[model samples]
Target: MMFEGFLFVIHLFLHTYCQLQVVAQCFINLLRWWRVNKWNADIFLNQTKNLGKIPGHVSLMFLEEDTPVEDIVKPIVWCICLGVTTISLYDYYGRLRSKKLDIDKELREYYSDFTKNCRNSPKNQPSPRIQFVSVENGRTDLVYAARDIAQDLLNGVVKEVTKVNYQNYHKVFRNDHPDLMMKFGIHTTLAGYPPWPVHLTEIISLPTCHMISPYNFLDCLNRYFKIEKRVGK
Candidate 1:
């Protein structure tokens, strides 16, 4: 009976050790796969740049309010320097009372400074246009405005609909659409960004927006290039 009990203890220990070994091996393999995927993504990005088809418009989404405006603006500057045309910045938490107004004021000030500095710089080109929209509040306003206009047209209060096209509707919403949306958060959720512009927009979620760098921006562009956009086919 003593010998049997000792054998049972040894068997349990061996089983536990094997299970731990399996888990460790899985973790190592996952790490290896991640490294390889990153390497491949880098190579693909370089090749795409060589092909000269960078994303035209990029949107960034984040929740934090205290994140320095410079952290957001610097990335936009870098994207513009890289020849991206339109940049959209969305603050999810800006929907709170007075937050959106504060954000807008700060952005306007930053943009004014940025443009002033760019004009003074010798290497200045046409800077990309930056637009800030609070996801929840802005979208609601846009939808309401559109509904009012449509209602007016139906009631014949506004005569003569000159154009009946998608572009006309786009104009109504001010044409603030994005080609790729980069989300800076732990979760992959969109956090209530406007649904109208993202019909085909590629969303890339990053771990966090605390310490964004130029390389991180480049990686986003790389990921954007990997997406094959099939527009409503």
Candidate 2:
């Protein structure tokens, strides 16, 4: 069991480390190579060019230095990944332990025990609603990034509520979630317009993917802007 737990830890950390690296790489690339004309977006280049080939040999151009060396120098990526995995493992373990404890608790012996289902019934569902205050669909990546940033603002609590003001939630979403770009259902290269995806149908059918759920607000907005942009092009 301990060995299994250790392996789980290693896996979780590596995953997060990889994710961070990917996010960092994509962000840098977007700032540099992803511009309208492959512009030299060298914001960091000017800041650290004088630092020399030390301090893990970090580079502003493409982080090419440390990544290759990390593979040899104790495999830093793996270490970081392991660390992330350890935290995830502990969190899951704690939750499981709590659930097990709850299950093991002795029932009220001499009193009538009533078990109540905690789930919200059909009537408790949020009304079928779509609120799109704004939409921008120039690039799916940009839209995806915005959605991620918006979602993160709620810090997972957004999963339960409605009505969002970006001021309160922008930090949580920011560039943290690259996976959100994946949620748009297609990877759009900047060369030209990407082929229309069938998933757009679901968006068009009712302007939402998950019934009356609010998760698709920004998602739909993204598509809306993308469509308009394509038409304007």
Candidate 3:
């Protein structure tokens, strides 16, 4: 009778152990499922949020002194597809004007090929107006800024006119300011972008410009949206 009792206790213990093992496995699976579902949900929510918000204007600055204009065309096209109305590309070296003919030729070829290949080409949609500016333009604006300050002083526009008045006058040359500006290079410096437009603009730095993908452009837009801009308010 004692031997039978011992056998019965052993069986009970084995059964309990098996049940515990099953429970532990189930718990682990449940945790994995929860994590996977949560990750998928977060991705879906982010995509939905980005779709609702689109920047009106975007700007790109090539921090490197002699960046080729050809390297910028793809990024500009990607920005246009994102529904940007205005795009300003700035290069510190001012070589863009010299390469204008080559850039124009390449752009025309790209447009032709894009219309032929892309089934949902943005050609039918409103395209962004692209403008190229240089550090020289910003320097020239300093002269305008000085002139405006003198005029404001002479006319007594305000009791105490400061740098803000000068910035306001500098806007006359280019009215459409960048909503978001991305600097392409190792560093985050503006490299002489006009100060007036950047007061409210969000700036981001990209590692490089060569062989940049559309996803990189989208990532910059995403980063822009994630920031909270006070605009000195």
- lDDT winner: 3
Model 1 Cα lDDT, one tens digit per residue, 26-58: 996676455323432224334345635766788
Residues 12-62 of candidate 3: C-alpha lDDT, one tens digit per residue: 999999999999989966764553233322242344354556777788888
- Off-target runs (Cα >4 Å) in candidate 2 are 34-233
What shift in Å separates residue 199 of candidate 3 from its native position after superposition?
0.6
Cα displacement (Å) at residue 163, model 2:
80
TM of each candidate vs. truth: 0.59, 0.17, 0.63
On the 0 to 100 scale, the lDDT of residue 232 in model 1 is: 78
TM-score sort, best first = 3, 1, 2
Model 1: clashing residue pairs?
none
The C-alpha lDDT values of all candidates are 0.63, 0.27, 0.68
User: How far off is residue 184 in model 2, in Å?
Assistant: 41
**Lowest-sum lDDT 10-residue window in model 3:** 36-45
For model 1 the TM-score comes to 0.59
Best by TM-score: 3
RMSD of each: 10.8, 25.1, 16.9
